[model samples]
Structures are given as structure tokens and as C-alpha cells.
Target chain A: MLEATIDASLLKDSIESLSVLVDEARVHISPEGIGVKAVDPANVAMVSFELQADAFDEYQAEESEIGLDLTRVLDILGVAEKTDKVKMKLEEDSRKLSISIGGISYTLTLLDPSTIRAEPRIPQLELPAEIVVNGKGFSRTIKAAEKISDHMSMGVEGETFFLEAEGDTDRMRQEMPRDELISITPGPARSLFSLDYLSDIAKPASKSNEVTLQIGNDFPIKINFEIAGGRGKVGYLLAPRIESE
Target chain B: MLEATIDASLLKDSIESLSVLVDEARVHISPEGIGVKAVDPANVAMVSFELQADAFDEYQAEESEIGLDLTRVLDILGVAEKTDKVKMKLEEDSRKLSISIGGISYTLTLLDPSTIRAEPRIPQLELPAEIVVNGKGFSRTIKAAEKISDHMSMGVEGETFFLEAEGDTDRMRQEMPRDELISITPGPARSLFSLDYLSDIAKPASKSNEVTLQIGNDFPIKINFEIAGGRGKVGYLLAPRIESE
Candidate 1:
């Protein structure tokens, strides 16, 4: 028997927001972390997510640490009567997770954790430029980029940051002045990435006004947001488009 | 000239939520009453929504109406810089709506208002049975029903209410005892409907914990949710599925 308590609504909202961009059917869960990885059906985009066990109120598993289908758990959690507290219990068989909230109880079956595979990490590179801005500002910028094109090119110069997207039908650009930004430290950086992925990862960041972003030329961008004074980091690796001659 | 002021975040959030279930390309807007309507591609579901002028700090129009490609408006609204106030301006000649918030400005072109068709209302429904329950609870119940079957049968006996779905591979049922119900006033009848339609209409209800449902024998079910304390209504009209002999 195992038990843990958390703000049911908070966790549920977070999962719902994230699951929109990633599949919940196959998620990786471990004592150290919980994550998901799926490539877009078009094979052009890949999404990977990881949540450290520290994110949990009580992370415990005696011997059976496993992956579970997040879709079912999210479904059960979605129906949970919203209340201040949510309690989770693991039965002896370890095949089901029982959730209780506001006097309502729901039992959700788990899938074989072994079926989920770990996402391969891309090689790390030294990002050239990093900037810190309000999380809300970053989200706004990406959203604007989305209107012009599905892909966007970003770069930093001195104190100015820029996002540019141009398509056959539309062109959009957003430039943020250095003074308006929380912090802008220029370094080596210029990259083009999928705006859709950036928008999805920026969701949690939208909750807060402030966030920090690390950018590198043709490398993964790291966006960090503060939750309860701690940090939640979303690292996005976008492959550069190869121009056909 | 048209201008309106609202809590930038609230309007943004509400519209975003509505956009998920609505196709952005074709949505009709009317000033006769502040409302929007759109028929789903399949014509099986029609979403009717109205937000009272009170929800806005300033609502003014010169008896003018317009139809907009919701995608453009939503895109602009989604990117509005977070500020206390959002300002909107409409230009007649250019046929563009300009939005400004937190010093950022966006312009979206409007579609020909004439092309937008208003949703026709079925003669006032004389629903026989009506029940009130936690809005969130009802949404969850329907979600569960969706998990088991595409069509759900809803019925009431005295005070007891039931939702049942049976498929070749799965069957799900949810029962609410009359005693546990918030309010149950028996009227004319029971009905079966497409779970898909119910789920779409139940979205706004999730914001509130209470909802009212009206059912008539083998007739369309009407679900109503209050927005801004009865000032606004979001309703749905879903055709009933005929059972085969």
C-alpha cells in the first residue's frame, strides 16, 4: 500500500496542458524521472518531456518502478471531483492506481511499463547567447511567429532579440528591445526551429511573467520557468531544415 | 467604429477554449445579441454562444455585425501582451480589426459578414425532464461514457438518473441517485444522443460546477450553463440517433 497527497487540480491542469502536444499513451516513468517521447506523424518534429521525481509530493515504489499509460491516468484524474487535496494509492498487484478526491474514488489500470522506451538524448552543444525575459513575453513572441509561418528563425544582437517567420502567404516579425527584457546577455547564437514546438513548450511558462531562455546556434534551446521558487526547465531540440538546392 | 474593453486574460482564455471545439475559418458573429454560432462540418452539432455586453467594460457598435475567420482573430488575441486592458478597433473600409494590449498592436482582416449564416433555432423545445447537477461532474460522466461507446442513452426515473453506453467490446454506465442529485424535476422523457456532441458542448460547463440538463423523449437534449451569473448562455443542439430495428 502506498499513499501520496497533492493539489489535485494543479497536477491535473499541468498534465492536461502538456498532453495536448504529446501523447499520453506511452510515457516513461522512473524513480528518477517521468517522461514522454513521440515523433510527429510527419516525421519532421519530435517531442520529449521529463519531470523529475522531485516534482512529486511523495515519490515511492518499493520494487516495481514502471511506466504507465498516462492517457488512462489523465482520464481518471480529469474526472476527479475537484478539491483541495488528491490522494493516490497503489494496490498490492501494482496494476492499478486508485485516486480519491472530494469523496470520489476512481481506479485506473496501468500498462506494462516496459513497453515505453527512453528517449535518446541529442548531443549537447555550447549555446552562444542566453536571455532572460518575462515568460509571458516569450509566449507572446512565439504566438506571433506562429501566425506568419510554422517555422521561425531567432537571433540575438547586442540588446535586441528577434523572431522572424516568412511563408508564401504571410510574413511576421517580432523584436523585443533589450531594456524591456529582464536580462539579455549576448553570446554566439542564431537558430531556426519549429514554432509549434516552441509554443507547446511555452505553455507552463505562460503562467508566470518571468522566464529565462538559453539559445545556441542550431542546438536545443533551454527555457526555464519558476514554480514555487523552484525551476522547471523545458529543453527543446529542433533539427535545422536542410535547404534543397 | 467599434470598441470594447475586457479583462485581456479572461477573454483570451475563454476564446482559446472555444477555439478548440470551433473551426476558426467560419464563425458567425451578430450584434442583435452578443453571440457566435457555428455548425460543425458534419452538421451533427451546432454550438451557440452568447456573452452579455456586461462581460465587457465597454461594448459599442453602430448596429453593425461581422463574420471573421476566427483563426486570425484568435491568433491576434492569443498573442496580446498581458495587460490589464485589451482594446479593439474596427475599420470599415480596410475591413480589419485592430487590437492593442500592453503596447502591442495586431490587425486582422475580417471576412464578408454576409457570407456568415445565422443558426436557426428549433421551435422552443418543450423538454419533459430537467435535472441539475455539478457541471464538472456531468462532463466527467460523459467523458467516461465516451470511453466505452460513441452513443449514450440518458434516462430519468423519478429522481434517479442514468447514462448508459454499450458497444460490442465495452459497456459503461453511470448512475446518480435522486438523493445525491442537486435537483431533479421530472418532465416528459428520456433520450439517446451522440456522445461526441455532448462532449463538445460540455467544455464551457467545466468552468462551473453546476449545470442544468433538459431532456425530452427521443428528442434533442438541451444543456445550459450560466456564464457571468445568468447574463450569458452557452447552449448546444444535438440530433438524437435513431436506434435500428
Candidate 2:
């Protein structure tokens, strides 16, 4: 059982972070907070999201896991004003979620957790380099890269972090030194990633003030950021596309 | 020959005023200003547009008629910021229009005026009633009506101007008494129009401060609004859809 009241935008942004990777997600609700880990159908990208109980004005829950159809929730939230407070309550007997905003109440049928694909084990890797940059600038770089190629390379050299994309006839690149970035732990790190995943992930990251990136040679890159005014956290892992010489 | 430089937004908005009704149009350029009059393919609606010379920062031209593919111009303008200065010049010998924004230059081939449809003759309609209202409010009313039906009715009764739409199961109405409107010349006037035309026309109309509407029973409706800080004017005439009763 779960009951909570939170800002509409907070919940909407949290759901959007995970929805960028998967249509359906298994959400774990507890007295501490709400958590969701989902992988895209192609298994090329994964998203892990967590919202602390402090993010909500009121919160109460028993340890429980439920499946959610993110698209449907987004549709309902679309009608809510950003400043409005959203109230959500789960009916254990009916297996439905009751969401109310203003005077409108929407009853959404919940999906069964057992029917969803089992959550994958998150791999642990000690990536050698870490870079913390302004989310807006990083998002802009990814958007500009999209015009040049389907895939782009990110690397750290000395005190600078660089992102570059190359096409047959066009190229784009952006570099930020340690002085320009929020922070940097430069090392030997470079990897190529598909714009498809970076572009979707950028939408949510753009709203954050600081986004952290961990990279290693030819290894999956991890992106981490905070949402809901630093009360919530979101992380994304994208498999790199190895260049063919 | 013509050579002119103007704010990108002013030119874009003026062209948009006419493009909403037709994809291509015959433009008349003179030292006085620029003018265009065209009817949609179905000949159900017609648009008249004008941008005075004073609206441009630099203006020079000879009396000339050119066929413009509005889609192409809008595409080029899409890359320009609203504040950017757009320079346009006609090359009579090459039958092309040279448009420059910032450092980018695009030479667009002009269509042969004779190959395009002949300009339509705007019928002189003596509508008995006139209502002047806030463009934003009028635009909002039209948008709300769209949610109910494909057609909407406008009429004046005594001191109030009323706009309404009705569907099989839903209806919407917005009434502005003389006190609420900027001005009103009330009389026996009512007409029904298709939303397809009003919705498109509303795109540019919504930006104006005041919009004037003239109506007559079962007759075409005339809508007039200004652009470019009143330096430009646009008028539209749409045939009414007679109720099948």
C-alpha cells in the first residue's frame, strides 16, 4: 500500500527520466522513497531513478513493488499544472492507483509486477575518469552533435573533457577544460555512443544544474544527475559503439 | 529590382499571414511597400497582406510582380533568429530571390507568375455589423470551439457579440458585450465558418492587439488585423457554410 502527495512536476520529471529508456517499469515503493530501474528493449541503455520521501509533502508506504505503464501516467500528468499538488493512493483490493489533482480524479489500472521482465543486475565498474559539467551545456553539445553523425565520441585528455561527432562531410566538437567544468578527474578515457540514447537522456538531464559523467576506454559511460531539487537522483548507463577502424 | 533589409520576424510574420491561406502567391513590390493577395486552392478563403516600406530598416524597389513559393522562404527564415536582419534582393536577369541572414545566403528560384494560378478578385461585401475585440481572446475562443465542432457561428445581438460551436454531445460559447469589446457596431448578423480556415488564420491573428470582424447573414466573413507593430496589415475573407436545415 502507498499514499503520497507531491508536486506534479517532481513526479512527472522522475517518471520521464525512466520512461526515456523503457515504456514499462517496475517501481519499488518503501517508507524511504520510490525507486525504479529499467532497461530499453534493445538492452543498449539503462536508467535507475530514486525519489526520497522528503521530496513529497506527505508520504506513507509499506515495502511493495508494482509495475507501471509510464506512457499512461505521463498522459494523465499532462493535464496537471506544474505548480499543482498531485495525490496518489493505491487500492490494494482493486489493484488500481487513484490519482487526484485539483477536482479531477483518475483511476489507473496497475500492471502486475510478475508480468514484467526481471530487472537486470547492474554491473559495477571502476571507470578511470569523472567529469562534472553544467547540464544545459552538455545537452546542447549532444544536440549539435546530432547534426553531424549518428554516433559521437567523448574523451578526457589532461584537464579537458571533449565531445566530438564526425560525418562524411561535416564535423562538430565541444571541449571544456577543468576551469570551465564544475569539476573533473581526468584520465585515459574515450568512448563512442549512439545519439539515439544520448538525445533521449539529455531531455531529463537538461533540467538539472549539474550532471556527472564517468568514462573508461571502450566501456559503457555512466551519467548521473539530481532531480526534484536535489531530493531525487537519476543515473543512466549507455553501451558504447566500438568504432570499426 | 528590389533590395531590402528587415527584422526576420516582421518578414516571417507577414509572409505567414498569407501562407496560411495559400502555399504560393503573387507578390507586388513597389517603392511604397510589399503586398500579396491570394486564395486557397479550394477558393474558399482569401488573404490580403501588406507591409509598408517604413517597416523595413532599409528599403528600395521598382514596381515588380514576383511569384513566391512561401514554403521555401519560411524554411530559410526558420534558421534566422527573430532579431536577425534579413536582406532580400531580386535578380531580374536570373529570375531568383537572394536572401541573406547573418553570413548565410540562399538563392531561391522564383516560379513563373503565369504558371501559377491567377489571383482571385476579392468581392466587395457590405456586412452590416462590425466587432472589434482583443486578438488573443478571439484566438482563444476559436481554439476552444475547435474542441467541440468543425464549424462555429458568429453573431451579434443587441449589445453582445457571441461566438459558439456545437457538437453532437458538446458545445462551447463565448460572448463579449459591447462593454468588454474594444468596439462593436451591432446589427442583425450571423454566419457559420469552418474551423479549418479560422484555426489557421488565428495563428497570425493571435499576435495582434486588435482584430476586426465583419459579419452578414449567410455571407462571407472578413477578418482584419495588423502586424509589424501596426506597420503591416492583413485581411482574410472566408466563405460561410450554410446550415443544412
Candidate 3:
């Protein structure tokens, strides 16, 4: 059972982060916080999200697991203003999520959690390079790369972090030296990633001031960023796409 | 031959106004100005647009009649900044329109004028009801109506001007009394129009302070708005849908 009120924008942000990877998710709600761990259908990406109880204006819940359709919730939130407080409660009888904004109420049927894909284990990784930069700047670079190619290479060589994409005739490269980045633990690390996953991953962090990236050669990258003024955290793990020489 | 240089935003606005109704149009470029008159495919609406030479930073023409595809021009302008100056010149050899904005050069092949639908005669009718209101307000009402229905009624009753849309189970109505309206010449007139046309025609005027609407019972409504400041004028005539009682 869960009944809480949070900023419409924060909830929308959280849902968007989850929707980018999985359409349906089994959300774990406890007095401590809320969590969603899901892997995309293609198994190329995994999303791990947690929002502390303090993130909500009013939060009270018993430990419960509910299956949610991210897209449906997102649509309801779409009509809400960023500053509006969205109250959500799980209806006991119908097992539906009731969302109330002003006078409007949206009831979403809880899906059967057993129908959702099995949760994936969080992979332990010790990436050699770490880069911290403005999330919006990184997102923009991803978009520019999208205009030219479908894949981009992320690497750190010495003190510079580089994002490069090559099309048949056009190539795009964005470099942020140590001075330009928030922080960089640079090394010789390179990994290619599909823009399809990279672009959507940027949605939740687009407004963030800083984003952390942990990368390794030909390995998955771990992206972590804070939400709701550090009251919430979202981590994305995207498997790298190998590039043929 | 035609040559002109204009602010990227101004040209984009003008094209967006006409593009809302017709895809291809015959653009008449004369020494004094540029004009486009065309009708939508369904013959439900007609758009007439004109920009005086004053609208351009530099203008020169030889009364050329060339066919243009608004969608293509709009695509090129999509990449330009608001302050960028777009220089357009008719290629002498290829008969293509060469659009140059900084380093980007887009050559759009001109369609044969004869291939486009014949220009329609501007219908002359005196509409009794005139209501001037914020274009954005009207546009927003149309968008909100679209969320519930495909058709809406526009009318003037006493000192109030109203737009009402009714769905099977929902209804939305927006009224602007004389005090709220910029100006009003109240008359007993009501007309039902398709949101498909009304929504798009409001694009160019969405940000404008004032939009002039002329309506008569079961007759075509004339929407007049200024674009590119006062240097350009756009008029749209939309046939009203007769309400089946």
C-alpha cells in the first residue's frame, strides 16, 4: 500500500527515466524509498532508480510490490504542471493506481507483475575511467552526433573526454578538456554506444548540472545522476556496441 | 528572377502560415513584394499571403512566378537561428532556389508552375461579425478542443465571442467578452468549422497580439493576421461545416 504526494515534475522525470528502458516494471515501495530495476527488452540496457522517502511532500507506505505501465502513468502526468503536486494512491479493491491532480483523477490498472520480464542482476563493474560533465552539454553532444550517425564513441585519453561519431560523409567530434569538465579521472578507455540508447538515457538527466560516467574499454558504461535535489538517484547501465575495424 | 534577404524567423513564419493549408503553391515575386494564393486539397480552405518589399532586408525581382514546396523550405529554415539572415536567389541555369544561410547552402528545385493546381479566385463576401482577440488564446482554445473533438463552433452572441467544442461525453467552451477581446463588432452570427483547418491556420498568428475574425451564419470565416510585423498580411478563408441536427 502506498499513498504519496510529489512534485509532478519529479514523478514525471522518474517515470521517463524508467520508460526509456522498460515499458512495464515491478516497483518496490517501502517506508525507506521506492525502487525500479528493469532491463530493456533487447537486454542491451538496464535502469536502476531509487527515490528516497524525503523526496515526497507526504509519503506513507507499507512494503509492497506493484506492476506499473510507465507509458500510461507518463500520459497522466503529461497534463500536470511542473509545480503541481500530484497525489498518488494504490486502490486496494481494484489494485489500480489512482492519480489525482486538481479535480482530475486517473485510474491505471496494475499489470500482472508475473507477465513482466525477469529482473536482471546488477553487474559488478570496475570501470577504469570516470568523467563528470554537464548533463545538458553531454545531451546536446549526443543530439549533434545523432544528426550525423547512429553510433558514437565515448573515450577518455589523458585529460580530455571525447565524443565522436562518423557518418558516411560527415563526422562529429566534441571534446572537453580537463578544465572544461567538472572532473575527470582520465585514462586510455574507449567504448562505442548506440545513439538509440544514449539519446533516451539523456532524458532524465537533461536538466541536471552534473552527470557521472564510468566507462571501460568495450564494456558497459554506468551513468549516475541525482534527481529531486539529490533526494533521488537514477543509474543507467548500457552495454557497448562493438565496432568492426 | 528573384533575389531577397530576410530574417530567418520572418520567412519561416510566412511559410508556416501557408504550409498549414497547402503543400505546393505558386509564389509570385514582383519588384514590390511576394505573394502566394492557394487552396487546401479538400477545397475546404484557401490561404492568401503577401509580404511587401519592406519585409525583406534587400529585395529585387522581375515578376517571376515559381512553384515552391513549403515543407521543403520549412525544413531548411529549421536549422537556422532566429537572428540568422537567409539569402534566397533563383538559380539562373537550374531554375532552383538557392538558399544560403551562413555556411549552409540548400538548393531546392522549383516545381513547374503549371504543375500546381490553378489558383482560385479570392471570394468576396461581407461578414457581419468581427472579433479581434489574442491569437495565442484562440490557438490554445483550438488545441484544447482538439483533445476532445474534431469540430468547434465560433460565434458572437451579444457582447461575447465564444468557441465551443463538444465530444460525445465532454464539452469545452472559451468565451472572450468585449472587455477581454481586443475589439468586437457584435452581430448575430455562428459558424461551425473543422479543427483541422482552424488549428493549422492559427500557427502563424499563435504568438500575435491580435487576430481578426469575420464570421457569418453557416458561411466561411475569414481569419486575418499580420506576419513579419506589419510588412506582411495573411488571410485565411475556411468553409464552415453545416451542423447536422
Candidate 4:
């Protein structure tokens, strides 16, 4: 059994982030919070999201695993205004999820959790270099880089963190010294990543005030940020694409 | 010869309205104002746009017809900030039009006016039914109708003017009475128009505060609106698609 009410905009953004990798998700819900972890079909990226119970106006659950079609939920939520509050409920016997926003209720059938691929285990890594900055600044760089190439490199050198993308005709480099960013611990680490995945990951993170990045040489880089006024946290990991030179 | 300076945003919006119909245009420049009249490739819609001399900070020109690739200009103008002032100049000897906005100056090669289709004479239309309302409201109705069907009916009966679209399974309608509109001259006229043209025309008109529409039985309807602080006027004419039985 589960019932909850939350900001429509936050829920929409969360679902959009999940929808980036998978069409459906089996989210673990309990009295404490809701969490989801999944890897892309290509196995090049992993997405993890969590929202504390405090994120909702009112929450009630008994450690249930709810399977939902994120795309369908996103479509229903698209009609909601930013300030609208969405009330969601999962009955004990019904296979449908009832979502109500501003007098409009949508009954969406649930997906089969058994049909979904098993959740991915969170990998433990020791990344030495870290860089933190405003999400907008990072997202802007990603967008600008896309105009030049489909891949970019993020690296730390001395007291500066840099992102660069190069094409046959043009190259764009964005460098921010320690003083220009929220924080930076230079560790002489560098890795090349596909901009396609980074660009999508940056979209939701861009809405946040700060995005913390953890990087290492030729390893998966972690992009983490908070939403729902800090009541929720999202982390994205993308494996590097080593150059064939 | 011609040289003019205007608000970048005003120029952008005007170009966008033109782009909706055709990629190239032959604009007649005079001391009074600038005007362009062209029909879409499908021959279903014609657009006429003009901005008075007062719309620009500076204006000077001899009677001349200059051809331009509006799509290219729009792409260059995409870089301009709204408040930026754009200076434009054309020389009698050169086949290029130079537009300077902010610190960037773009020289665009012009298409030969002789290569473009001959200008069409403005048809002396006698539309009886007239309705004036918020452009945004009308555009919203058009967008909603698009979801239902590809064609819609517009007509006046009693005191209300109605727009309705019907799909295979769903239908949508918007109706407004004389008192609800800016003004309405009730006439027993009705016509069916291709939503494809009306929806595109409504996009730019929707930005205006008021749109004046004139309609007649099974004939073409005229859509008129003003922009750039009322310094410019736009008129769109769309031929009606006669309904069969």
C-alpha cells in the first residue's frame, strides 16, 4: 500500500531523468523514501536516483516495490502546471496506479517487475580528482561542445579543471580555475566521454544549483546533484571512450 | 541604396513570420516603410508584412526591391539578443546584404530578384464577417484543434463565433460571443480551412495582443495583427478548403 503527494514539477523532472535510460522502472518505496538504480541497455552508463520521504507533502508506504511505465507517467504529468501538486496512490489489490492532479486523474496500468532487468549494483571507485560547479555553467559548456564534436574530454591540471571538444574544423575549450568553481582538487586525471550521454545527464543536473563531479583516468566519471530542494539526490556514471590513436 | 537600424527582436520576429511561409522574399524598400508579399509554395497561403519608418531608429532608402534568403538571415539573427540594435545596409553594386548586430556583422548573399516568382497582385477581397480577439487565445484554439483534426470550420451564428475540429475519435471546439471578443460584426458566413496553414500562421500572430479576422462563406479568410510595439502590421490570407457534403 502507498500514497503520496509531491510537487508535479519535481516528480516530472525525476521521471524525465529516469526516462532518459529506460522506459520503465521498478522503484523501491518505503516509509523512509523511494529509490531507483538502473543501467542503460548499451551498458555505457548507470543512473541512480533517491528521494527522501520528506520530499513529499505527505507520504505513506510499507516497503513496496512499485513497477511503473515512466514514459506514461511523464505524459500524464506533462499536463500539470509547475506549481500543481500531484496525488498518487497504489491500492493493495489493483494493478493500476492512480495519479491525480488538479481534478484530473489518470489510471495507468503497472508493468511487470519480473520482466524488467535486474537492478545494477552500485560500483565502488576511488576517484582522486573532484570538481564542483554551478550546473548551468557545466550544461552550457556541454551544449557549446556539441556544436563542435560528439565527444569531449574532462580533465584536471594543476589548479584548473577543463573540458574540451574538437572537430575537424573547430575546437572549444572551457577552463575554470579553482577560484572560479565551487571546489576543485586537481589530481592530474583526464578521461574522454561521449557527449551524447553527458548532454542528457546535464539537462536535469542543470536545474540544480551545484553539480559535483568525480573523475579518474580512463574510468567512469560520476555526475551527482540534488533536487526537490535537497530532499532528493541523483547520481549518473558514464564510462569513458578511450581514443583509438 | 538602403541603410536602416532597428531593434534586433523586431527584425527577428518579422523574419520568423516570413520564414513560416517561404525561405526567400523580395522586399520593397521605400522612405515610408519596408514591405514583403509572398505566397507559400503550396499556393495555399499568402503573407504580407510591413514595418513603418518609425519602427526603426534610422531609415533611409531609394525605391528598390532587394531579394534575400530569409532562412539564412534568421539563422544569423538567432545569435542576436533581443535588445541589440541591428544595422542593415545594401549597396547598388553588391549582391550581398550586410547586417550588423552587437559586434558581429554577417554578409549574406542575396538571391536574384529575377529568379524569384513574380509578385502577386493583392486580391480585392470582400469578407463580411469580422471578429477581433486575443491572438494568443486564437492560436491556442488552433493548436488544440490540430490535435483533433487536420481541418476545422470557422463561422458565426446568432451572437457566437465558433471553431471546431473533429478527429476519428475525438473532437474539440472553441466559441466566443460578441461581448467576449474585442469586437465582432456578425455575418451568416462559414468556411472550412486547412488547419495546416492556419496553425502555422497563428504561431507568429499568437504573439500579438489582438488578431482581426475577416471571413466569408467558403472563401478565403484574412488574418491581421500588429507587432513591434504596433510599429509593424502583418496580414495572412489562407484559401478555404470547401467541405464535401
Worst 10 residues of 1 chain B by lDDT: B24-33
TM-score of each: 0.55, 0.55, 0.55, 0.56
Model 3, range B1-245, lDDT digits (tens) per residue?
A: 87899999889888988899988899998999999999999999999999999999999888778999889889889999989999999977536999999779888899999999988898998999999988977776776667547999999989989887776544556667899889999988999999988988888778788899999999999999887778889999999998976
Worst 10 residues of 3 chain A by lDDT: A100-109
**Over the stretch A1-245, how does candidate 1's per-residue lDDT look in tens digits?**
35566677656655644464555435545555455555443444455455555766676544344345556667777666565577777788877878877788878776665664444454565677878878777777777777757887777876777766665544555667787778788877767878777777777677766677777676656665555335233444455553222
lDDT of 2 by residue, B205-244 (tens): 9898899999989899999998878888999999999986
Model 2: per-residue lDDT, tens digit, A98-177?
A: 99997799999989988887787778979999999888877777766675579999999888898878765435556777
i-RMSD per candidate, Å: 3.5, 8.7, 7.3, 7.5
Candidate 4 chain A, poorest ten consecutive residues by summed lDDT: A100-109
Candidate 3 residue runs with Cα over 4 Å from true position: A1-245, B92-94
In model 1, how large is the Cα lDDT of residue B131?
Answer: 85
Best by DockQ: 1
Kindly report the interface RMSD of candidate 2, rounded to 1 decimal.
8.7
Model 3 residue A232 distance off true place after TM-score fit, in angstroms: 20
Residue pairs with backbone atoms closer than 3 Å in model 3 (clashes): none
lDDT for B8 in candidate 1 is: 81
- Pairwise lDDT winner, candidates 3 and 4: 3
